[model samples]
Target: MSVDTATATAPASATTAERQDVAAPSDRARAWLVLLLAGAFEVGYALAVGGSEGFTVLSWSLVAVVFFLLTLYALSVALRTIDVGIGYAVWAGIGAVGAALLSPVVFDETLSAAKALWLAVIIAGVVWLKLADRPERPDDSDRAAHPAHP
Candidate 1:
């Protein structure tokens, strides 16, 4: 077996820079957009399921299934870039608020002032979570391998 010592001992800084370059802002933006699309599908699935009456209604049941799969796929794609915790919370918040607001029209459900206030709270929480998140990038493992000062 031939050993490539030169490649093995390449400075860790190069790896760190490469990873940093990989975490592009455009990718993050695309992730957020995909997350939003997933949330929208969530709302669609919820409404379809509700209308399906436990799969008793064939057309609505099919719609629900399609939306459910789409939601999962979109969420998984977004998770490649977005933090799972923040991504999921935001996704759930969007679905919850959207369904709650939409239920009245779709299913003749009720939405009181208290419900509105709670939905607003959920929105605020999602915003707060997003703002609190640190920009994603490679961790300090590379730095640990090769101390910055050294």
Candidate 2:
């Protein structure tokens, strides 16, 4: 049998759109994803801590520790690309709102309409934070200096 390493090792050429679908995500996108995951873990951590009852319960205590570590890891990953101020605020907001809403159902806590409204406001603020951070697309004159990548 003859070897055919050329065909096997050759790199594939793809259009920009196709490449985008298959390519590793941009730093910003990955950071946002990590931030969101961190926020979710934060909620889990809060719940676990409450369930642990000052760490007296071994199982819940372990759960709290695991979620806390995971949340911190995700936050650190996100910090690589995301601004600490914006990311931390958004992450903490998500955790707080998630925990508050979930607590009523999961831990028999109170959930008033005011609390829900305030949470919605926090979500809106986060959206604005993201929007404000985005860089505007270069105009035609500026585009000449900074061409689009293939």
TM-scores for all candidates: the values are 0.77, 0.73
Estimate, for each residue in 1-150, the C-alpha lDDT of model 2 and write its tens digit. 885532232124543333323333365687788899999999999999999999999999999999999999999877655667888998998899889989887787898999889999998998888776554445787657645421
Q: Which portions of model 1 show Cα errors greater than 4 Å?
A: 1-21, 136-150
Q: Deviation in angstroms for 39 in model 1?
A: 0.3
Which one is best on TM-score? 1
At residue 124, candidate 1 shows an lDDT of 97
Local accuracy of candidate 1 as per-residue lDDT tens digits, 1-150: 886532232243444234224446676688789999999999999999999999999999999999999999999888776767788999999899999999999998999999999999999998898776556444688557755412
lDDT of each: 0.81, 0.77
Q: For model 1, what is the error of residue 18's alpha carbon versus the real structure, in angstroms, after optimal superposition?
A: 11
| TM-score of model 1 (CA atoms) | 0.77
Query: What is the Cα-based lDDT of residue 24 in candidate 1?
Result: 62
